[model samples]
Target: MTGWRRRETKREEQIIRVLQEPPEAIDLRGARRWRWADEHWRVWLRRSATGVELFTRWQESDEYRYMLGDDAYQMQLIEILTRATPRDCAAAGFGCTRRMDRACSEPSICSRDPLPAAGVDPHREGPVPGGCDSFYGGDDVRVRFSAGNRHQAVRWSMSLWIDGVRVGAGLRLASSGWWLDDRFFVVPAEGPDEHPAQEYTMGDLVSVIHSVLIHDAALSVTRVLVPGPEEMWTEPWVVRDGDELRVYPDQETSRGPDRTIVLTD
Candidate 1:
């Protein structure tokens, strides 16, 4: 007998971008394989016997082979292969607007805008930060930052970028963010490191905490009731109030510190 089946609901279909065909310089035939698989990305190199044929799966999903025609990327991959260690794989500096895999199935679908040329400063200068938790929006107007580092007191520096420009330097705290619009983004901020135990009835670590951080296109950041109130660490409820967005401390009352963030452009 067949197992039980559920009816499928109609949903919007997403368009996945197909990578361009490889140039003549990169010949995949008879290439040496050097693979490195990790939790986030499963990357491997196809070294050409005579010329530059280096491929990386970290750029997109497993279906296609994305190759960089440049000799620099080829050399970098060779150096990492020579070391042949997990530490070397973790430390490898391969940069692109998006790593292509994680939350989104397709890199093109995940990134809302067209990615800039190879080695281009799509967001900020120098090298991109390590361990990117998630990508929001697109390369043009996007929010890229790390989250889920609650165990550590301090985390790597992260920041929001808009049109190749960094916003408000970088933040050390881990936070989950949502891009409300092209100009505004919101995050359920992880409160400060040191919370005194005596302040709450259930104690500091045991009691839940909540805070909100908002950023605008002008680089102005507004934090609402950061650290929250003592013993009232319940999750806040967000409601649409006229043209603005208001966050109540708890579902029980609409009164508290207001926590109102203006949404008007």
Candidate 2:
């Protein structure tokens, strides 16, 4: 009887332990809920009566990590293109195609080595370093030049100009050997005859600018001013040039000069 009782107690304790521990599987039914779907964690953000609610589904898997890593890389590219300046873009190889190929490859590991340095072989043809053409919107921007020997962190700068007048400058920091995600906005002239506000995607400009800056040893104009939208009176534009511009924008200007640039996580 004593032995039987002891065995029963142990079984009871085990059951209690299982119950006490947090559940590996979660029930997502609340306003903002995340759950496992298609072998991946799904996150949701819902608007509640009062405000907004957020939820997430936790998944422990390597594949999930890979997806997250890819997402991070894409976000980094966006940030670099948006916030980084011409010098920052050139040094970091913001729009180099060859470097992008290597960076996106299996061995590159987006976290370890984001962009290749200038002169360093990206192990591809076309150009050694990369170039920047125009700032648009996208997930991927090729980086050709290496980040120098320090390999400590990624650095970029931005100098805003209005009508050839320098207004402001910005600096960006990112993980070593990793590309930083950024975004940029440019407003040219407010007129009907000027070239319609041209949107240059980072992916499109990186290769051309990378080659021009890194290999060609030339400082070219990566950004140009054009007519903004008809509805909007003044438009702020992102400019990428080899040499830093003197004129920029006034942050406190009432003309909606305030620009919000960020990296999407």
Q: Could you give candidate 1's per-residue lDDT for residues 1-265 as a string of tens digits?
A: 1222222211211122223444344334323222222223332122222111222322222233235544444334333233222112222223322442223233222222222331122132112223322332222212332122111111112443333333334343223344443344455544444544223224222334555555553345454446533534355455444567666655655365355657555
RMSD of 1: 18.2
The local lDDT score (0 to 100) that residue 173 gets in candidate 2 is: 12
Model 1 residue pairs with clashes:
none
Per-candidate Cα RMSD to the true structure, in Å, reads 18.2, 18.7
How far is 2's C-alpha from truth in model 2 (Å)? 51
lDDT of each: 0.34, 0.27
